[model samples]
Target chain A: MVIQDLKVLICDDSMFARKKMNMTISALGINEVFEAADGEEAVAKYKENKPDVVFMDIIMPRITGIEALKQIIEFDPDAKVVMASSVGTQGHLKEALRAGAADFLQKPISDEDTRAILENAAKGVL
Target chain B: MFAQFFGGYLLHKKLVTSEDLTQAFEDKKHTRMRLGVLAINAGLMTADQVEHVNITQQSVDKRFGDLAVELGYVTEEQVDKLLSQQPTEYLLLGQTLVNNGVLSNAQFEQAINDYKTDNELTDSDLEGSKNESLNKLVTEFYHLEEASNARMLTDYVTMMFKNIIRFIDGDFTPLEAIVIREFDAETLIEQRITGTYDAVTCITAEKDVYFEFAKRFAGENFGDITGFENETVGEFLNVVNGLFAVNQSNEGGAELTMTPQQFIQDKKISFEKPAFCIPVVFSFGEVDFIVSTE
Candidate 1:
């Protein structure tokens, strides 16, 4: 899929974070973008839409990004979920990867980082 | 980080008033670092030598750096090194204060020397963002060593200042911290860190000041929205705590997690343990950060 054809879902409890990333993803010419304020909504959105890529924040209410990632993977084993978190500790990194995250990005994530991830997703490389 | 703390020290010493600092911070962006101040900061020339160079330059058409070299005060190579180095923020602040006559050159020299000697900081430490130097500055400035969790407190406060510089405004003066068990907050965002240890962190400020602080992080579009200021400030605290937790995990193998931030307005909250309430004054107003290790 080309970058313009990609659909993205952003899951973050912070309205500021979600709004910032949503603007970034939309700016990349991807018309379809989804947002969730918490992990429960993230899982529900994932199962409902199955976007091309998911940007998941680790610390959230209701459930964590890791738990949400596991649930999404159980529903679709080939899900492209990138764990975007401020806490990129070795423990969280190992746990996220073990739970089948496609990749991890540390915060505060830059615009270039988001663009690069979307490019990789479009190329089927994530 | 060093610049903010150095300003705090100057305020604590009463060398400069808060109004003087606020003005200097505003003007420092356009202030150029003079060669004499740079030389004095480098220890290559004393304040008297710098005065002599300034007086000599008034008579001769030669530049200050050239005259200093001709007078054997500093070598041409040293002058080049001093000029080539990008001026640090604290030095810019000092230069601005001097330009505005808030501080004399001699007073600036004495203040810089005493600041370094008192903090046991070297010139390199002041120029760079080294962790050890910063930890020492935070611990000594806040008297965090007296706390029960000195190491943890030092690490947390150091991380807090770094993020304040990173995400928020760097033009803030970190005031002295007070020990508090309870605080009546106008508007406060609270987040609890739990796991191997438990601690509470909070950010509180008045409505206008809180809105301005949030605007710095969330940009202008989200500024006037009702209830968004609390979310923006809460996210700032959340990001800082997340990074602190990650640092603790990486360096000390302490796994930590933070609960969703809670916003409380016009309420009284008390901590089970004493917390350090650090009041930092920005261009807008004062904001207090409270951290309690429970």
Candidate 2:
């Protein structure tokens, strides 16, 4: 299965950041894109849709990225999740990966990084 | 933009640690190089003079050009000439790029000329000297249709961010603002008069993170600032208001305007005023907020 054909979830509380993720994902040639306002939203969407990969943001309301990632992990240990955050979120990022984040993409998210993370994560599933 | 631009400058000079620079730069990275900083760094004026000018600008509705001219630092002719161009603070840009051979004077001049001609901005169009990130954040966050309202919102947020970022030492880390839906307008006004603004505003956030930001911001600056939450909430209201105003403008003006103000308590607090006051809950503890009126 091609990575571009897979479903992806972009979770961030920031409208700007969320839109950017949506745009970047769309620009990356991905068709089925999902979005959530925060960690709780991410979890609800994840449970509902179970996208191929989840792009989670650290430092969100209701659920921090790490906690959300852990919750997602608990649901599916093999869930391919990528953590998105600004610089200086090292411990959280580390904890996220430990909690089963497949990869981490630092903000401001760029085209190459999104492509690589999604493609790489997709390799594990599809 | 100001964050990146200013961060690069501070980092290049080793004036601030990479961490602090990053922290400050992140919140306001795109804030346009302040004219005062630009002038001072360019060796055109002293730091003290810049500080005084900034204070004066804040106190009055004076433009940089007006202030600079009033202070005799620059003549009306000099400012008028510079105003004719695009972000063309020659002394600052020239000095910044001169020592570094990234672009020559002629090339810079050509780029400026091209930038102006291609954009079709005449001398009359004075681009705001605000931090681009704050401007961008407000506009993008709201996604408003009213350009003027959006610009006002951007300016309001830019001012609020400038003051609030100081609380957490400048953290732009995003957070969710869980604004609670319950508030009795009369009780809120009564509390406002009695100096329970923080607690009153607290009832609105209700969420964990909103409480954290409120506690942290209020704990530090509450006593120092009377009518604290009313002012703080006003700032938050401005964010939400701007967002609402801008978004509603697209649908031919939704007629959403705020009537809440610093009440002196009692006397009905004007029952005729707009009843619905939204608690614009902020989820981030890092990004503190300040009061704004505009």
Candidate 3:
């Protein structure tokens, strides 16, 4: 359950934001990170890698985070998928948590949040 | 962005009182303006650096320093000295509000973290809340009409610069005293901008439109809140343009083409070209902003 040698998957539409998140997680030494452009790709990558942790943005083109979350969970009942969303996505957070996302990270992704989510992701696996 | 927009909505629905709404507005007003002052006070930029950029950006696509060089205001050496003085503390939304007593420092800090947790926002997501009507107008016009993804990127720029400038020269004004002005800057935007935009144009008595659209767009066409804001700023700019050009005759209409949005966070970064940009100052009730360019 521990993310030692953990593989991370980042799913979002913004290349700039995805780069920022990758850099932060990489700085934390969470190497072996994978990337997906939207919900469908995220679920596909999740299936391909079955990464220990996933950071999914709820509102992506094609399939949404919620739909993908459900799909990922269905594929792997223990899939650890966290969400990357804006603060305005408050209402959806409850639904995400209910839908089985491990945790959520806010936008303008920060070091503190990366640590928080990763830490929690470990807890979710255990 | 989340607080002001939601506070206004809650008030409108009578979920919260006018007092709560006013208090939040006052806090935002102080915070947004103070970030600029703090950036200046910290020597992030000299008065000349800011003023020179402001004056030049009014007419050029280039950023503050590019024009500073063109105008001989400061040398590259001086720019280096000033860049080191970035007001990291001041640029923080919570610190600005708390430091000014709009909210106690502790309270402001708590609210910000809570806001972050409550909203699950990334910084880029929060950046969308910082734009005004003009940017919104551009968002709609550029994204919808032109159908370019490039136009959608302005949210980050608007958020980062939302506090970059304020109407320091103006004092508090009421609804009766409020005035709206229009100008012709077609020569600078570099693109042939004709027609109207509307959206981010309405300041919502403060910067409360963030939540209004957040609520509206979250469940509809956009993804989640972050995705919603990511897309909204561009649309908002177009909406603002629509409202702004509501009455302009074609003969008197000003073409307002938008250049690609560039974010100059903390320090001054210059655009590479000259652009026809509009400078608009607005005061909604007692709040004020000096939007020189979108």
Best by lDDT: 1
- Report candidate 2's interface RMSD in Å: 15.9
Question: Candidate 1's residue-wise lDDT over B27-54, tens digit each?
Answer: 9889999999998899899999999998
TM-score between candidate 2 and the true structure: 0.36
Question: What is the per-residue lDDT of model 1 for residues A4-67, given as tens digits with 9 covering 90 to 100?
Answer: 9998999999888888888888888899999999999999999889899999999898999999
Clash number by candidate, in order: 0, 13, 53
True-contact fraction in model 1 equals 0.56
Ranking by TM-score: 1, 3, 2
Across residues B1-294, which tens digit of lDDT does each residue of candidate 3 receive?
A: 233332322333344344444444455445433322333433344444555567668888975555666677556666555455433321443333444444443343344444444444443444454344434533432232332323333442234223222212121111111223432211111111132331112222123433333333223334433444433433333223322332122223432222222211123222222211222222233222213222
Docking class of 3: incorrect
Better by lDDT, candidate 3 or 1 = 1
TM-score of chain B of each: 0.97, 0.27, 0.24
State the lDDT at B258 in candidate 3. 26
lDDT by residue for model 2 (A5-108), tens: 88999987655456556877897778999999778889889999989988887656676777888888898887888877642233444576677777777554
True contacts kept of 2: 0.00
